[model samples]
Target: MMLSPSDRIHAPVVLLVNPAAGRGRAGRVAQAASEALRAADLAVDVHETRERGDEARIAAEASATGARALAVVGGDGAISHAVRGLLDGEAGGGARVPMAIFAAGTGNDFAKSLVVPVHHVARMARHIAAGNTHVVDVGFVDDVPFVNAAGFGFDVEVLEHMRTPGVLRGTAAYVSTALGALFGYRGFRANMANDSAIMSRKLMTVFANGRCFGGAFRIAPDARLDDGALDCVTIRDISPWARVPLFARAMRGTHLTSPHVSFHRDHHFHLRFDTPPMFETDGELQQAATCDVSVSVRAGALTVIA
Candidate 1:
């Protein structure tokens, strides 16, 4: 990750606060997190983000320096941005930098996968100082990298519904949007092939780098962060009513047993859609340049504070 002009100050921790992320609570989380770090006698520099790409730009800047640890005070999108900044081109394949997280995003799925409790902001701060790093794999769709989960089909539609302003939070918000999207959303025709999977009409999915999405829905029960592969869980088209039970089972991670679901894991996957596909990576919506995508793994590319 690189630093911005605002991040020129020296501190043991370079804290990136995404003020606009996850409603309005990120500022509070940033304040509380800094207090915690200062309380531990560590010099903390809190850099509040002003725009969308600041996270990546500043993170890349910080990484270019010799900053000991970089912590993010936002949801997974902020993390995604910073990771992209850090790994942009040669930076990703070079010497790695450590990172910490203070979960303040709505989904916080990626943070949760690292077992970082949003409620324990101080502990997360302390972990930055402790600097015990754990290497974890990062999944990539072409050149763009994602920290948690990424995919298309129903998940993309669910994300579209999630974009609507609502009063709910966490899983409840996701559930409300998912239910609304389920009614009218239809799957796209697609073909996929990987070392562990080869299929067509594989219209839906929740390809995971971690265990879950939608706040705790276990998208992949057997996923391991350091496993050196991505877990691909594809869902065949089913009745909207049938989706209810399957989604319920997903909560407990038993949906894999369903006949409509197929599971595979590999270092790389190739996908082609009959039409262009819109997707999401770490809760951030995206679209592919063409009807094809190549998803690959950067085995243990990130060293996270856990």
Candidate 2:
């Protein structure tokens, strides 16, 4: 849905910028976005996040002060943090504030999920001004909100590797880490239960909320923003040699029909792994979990201006 400039809403908006995102360029991006928003005649309060999680803190505080919207200029991680904060506030009985994004991160998976053009800050500003807000669903992993996908096995291992020094960031970084994992990583065993069946897999599993991750890779092509359900993808055991082509096919989302690939749709599920596996939400690795991981969707939980 393309929004006209005249349709833009000039609601009270607070812009939270993460200076450290995208290799310390988020501040500049935020400044540019702020200038564009101001030029559009929108009232904008631009604030720089001093540290990690500050984006969410700032956003929550601004909403408490009667701000109706919170605009974020950063990468997926920053956006995730901000959303978590906003949802936290809502859980604590605060008003639900709408969100807008000015993509500044390396992959901007959430923006891609919304079909928001990454290179069009001016058009994004126009959309913001137009106030075209749509209610979207959010996924929860163990009751915490995640706006993107969650992964276990090889993907989680790759994210772990990317956090080390001398490791690059973005799609290339993920590819490198994925390659390393494919060559040397061993798969884990997990028992998963959905609405229809309970199954066990000895490979990789992904719960997708958004289609694209690690840049252009379409891990879940059929994912819908407001579908009120999550897509669960599990890849059964495959030899290392077979993984090469599988990885290639995943880039184009053509691996869905592979013999090892199994896809399911459900609103909720529980996953139990034989050994604790690393968990990631919106591409950020969380602490290893030994207990059953619960996943669900909050339908129409967030309002986003794309």
Candidate 3:
């Protein structure tokens, strides 16, 4: 279905590209997406991110300028940056615009969660031109917004290990780094509290708004984007040898049934680590300034063309 001619856009759709994403795949995706949008008779304004925080800045400017929509060509990290920008604008009373995501990152976890088409550029362009939109929830770690999962413990170590260059890329790189991390990475201790209960000695905990993490792990099998809540999954302290089977089961989302793991659903949570810790939100590393971090969900906070 398409929007009526009367509803057609008069403003340009801002195309924000992160050239470094997916080992430079985003540049090619941006080119094709731009061509497709132009062919569909939609005006496009292309911009490339050169530095660390460019995605959010460009997205904020686009929304503030009343752009028709913001089309992001990148992976989960880039999209998360854009989400933060959009939400920041919303909080400041700027125009709320729908986002079009072209997944060009290694994991592409957020795009997968939203069922966004990865290869069909022309179809996605048509969706954008038609103004097709869907509202979804957004998760916040302290003040930063994320469209996917916020991870702690083991996954943070996996990301740390990935800092060194290797022959592998994409999901292969993630898995290989994770396997390497398991050998030297011992679990961290934290206290997790929600509206219902408080638990301690957590090895890893995920505040999931999306179903998967690190490309392959179905960390939260039944999470829903618009559910107005989060799926909190935690792994308690276990021996490194014992974690091998747990890792295997997590790939299929069957680890939830394990005694060492626990799952709950809630709208808000407060997590306290033994010390300031490193964590990740939608594949972006974050350093907590203090030992305490708060997570909450904002229902229908984002509009996306899926």
Q: Cα miss at 61, model 2 (Å)?
A: 1.4
| TM-score, structure 1 vs. true | 0.90
| Cand. 2 TM to true fold | 0.91
Instruction: Give model 3's clash tally.
Output: 0
**Model 2 regions more than 4 Å off:** 1-11, 195-201, 288-290
Question: What are the per-residue Cα lDDT tens digits for candidate 3 across 1-306?
Answer: 223324436878999999988998898899999999999999999999998678999998877777889999988889999999988876776778899987788888877677656568888898898887899999998888889999889898888777766646679888877777776777887777652224455568999999999988999999999899999998887877888889889999899999888888998988887788899999888998899999899999999986
Q: Tell me how far the alpha carbon of residue 247 in candidate 2 is from the true structure, in angstroms, after superposition.
A: 0.7
Segments of candidate 1 deviating more than 4 angstroms: 1-11, 89-95, 164-170, 195-203
Tens digit of per-residue lDDT, candidate 2, span 23-86: 7677778878888888877888888888877877887775556564688888888888899888
Model 1 root-mean-square deviation: 3.6
lDDT assessment of candidate 3: 0.85
Task: Using lDDT as the measure, name the better of candidate 1 and candidate 3.
Answer: 3
What TM value does model 3 have? 0.93
In candidate 2, how many clashes are counted? 8
Ranking by lDDT: 3, 1, 2
